[model samples]
Target: MALSLMLRNCPKLKGLSALSRGTFPVSRHQNFTQLVCKNRTALPLAVKCHNQFVKAIEPTRKMSADHSKLWSIEKLFSLILLGVVPATFICPNKILDNLFAVAVVMHFHWGLEACVVDYVRPIIVGPVLPKLALGLLYVVSATTLAALIYYNQHQIGIGQTFRKFWCISGTPADNEAKNQ
Candidate 1:
């Protein structure tokens, strides 16, 4: 009765009862059930087509080698960063700056390594490319850290450089004259 009153008050609600039953008077040329597939076909796919099927992974290989030790090392690096960042800003010690350079570089290398492993995977990029990429990464990281060490030893070091950037209050010419 309430529905009837609504239909009487609003003529647009006349077909609302039909909509509730999903009885829209519409038809398609092709049945959707035949068009859309629900499950994978059991036909002899690429793997099944071959004679020698892939073997199952060994049960003993559940965890990687030195997994716990590696995790602890990563955590140690993180702790060092937690201290080094603030100390670099506040005190700007040469030893701490060296530590900061090494620790920060190592942390960044590991993160970038994970990204390379995920994206430039052996399966997708082929075995040769992945190995080559990883080798290149190691070379670049080594040379970069070496250069950083050289800079820390010879120049004003990373912390002092950052401090100088903050200390400069006047124009570039004035700052240069002051340093000179």
Candidate 2:
């Protein structure tokens, strides 16, 4: 019903019915826009429909100071990661290892959080599931960060671990010989 109403109101969707019914013969010469709507109406209606759709899909929100600061911080952290990653690999130590672990886990957390916020919206998957997903993300991120930190502290650091893994050869004895 809503789709039919949208089709009726939007002049551009006039040929949708014909297209659906297979009566509208599509030709290579005719552009998709031409096929969709041949209506020669004023541009205002199309603009109005577009604005309405945008408003409906994405509700406007006033950007707070904290949001702006967080955005800047995220961008800065990403830029820092570019340097931290290579530097950690080149000079693997306690400080660099811990830094690498924290940086990577935080980056992963932020990325996953963004995905959860964007895709697991209340409107799409109901209110409870979205909250639950976000909570689970936090839990997983915390656990991962804790594990990485523990590994860095207790055993070989992330950089050394990766370096060791990268140096793998045909056999364990061959690896040991190469290391020695």
Candidate 3:
């Protein structure tokens, strides 16, 4: 209503409403430009000026099959873990221990990677900090995976370790007696 009233009151602006509606006369383009130049505030709403200093950034890739494959693998690992957890506890063996170690570490790495990517974004933090955080995440993930693999190879292994944790019912001597 205000716009209609404004246009009705100002004959100069009557063509502007038509221009916004796409029915602007071709001959009026020059007149519109002149009017816009004269009254900078009256520049057409549809007209946009681009800044040459700002370069357009395009996505580095259209689509990545590898990302989809990674997503599928992550989901598969998650599902496998559902069974692997119980199986490891039920029968703690070298194969199940190693499987548990690999799957758990990969699951943890993926989950932490997601957290780091989402929370430690360069836009939120500074560029340097995000890169540092990602590097730290990689280091931590690799260390954890390596340690688990080592423990599985040389020690009682992940499954047996967890089983031992559940089996702890008393003090050192009491537990030793129970085991004996």
Highest TM-score among the candidates is held by which one? 2
For residues 35-146, write the lDDT of model 1, one tens digit per residue. Answer: 3333233222323323222221111234456668876898899999999988987888779888988999899888888788778966467899988888988998898899
Model 2: weakest 10-residue lDDT segment is: 14-23
When sorted by lDDT, best at the front, the candidate numbers are: 2, 3, 1
Expressed as tens digits, the lDDT of each residue in 1-180 for candidate 3 is 566545434654334445434333334446666656665555544352221111122213445456888999999999999999999999998899889888988999899889987788665577999888889988987898788888888999888898889977878999788879
To one decimal, what is the Cα RMSD in angstroms of model 2 from the true structure?
A: 9.5
Sorted on TM-score, highest at the top, how do the candidates line up?
2, 3, 1
User: Cα lDDT for residue 7, model 2?
Assistant: 50
> Which candidate tops lDDT?
2
Alpha-carbon runs more than 4 Å astray in model 1: 1-64, 173-180
* lDDT, model 3, position 96: 92
Lowest summed lDDT across 10 adjacent residues in model 1 is found at: 51-60
Using Cα atoms with residue i matched to residue i, what is each candidate's TM-score against the true structure?
0.60, 0.64, 0.61
> What shift in Å separates residue 47 of candidate 2 from its native position after superposition?
13
Between prediction 2 and prediction 3, which has the larger TM-score? Answer: 2
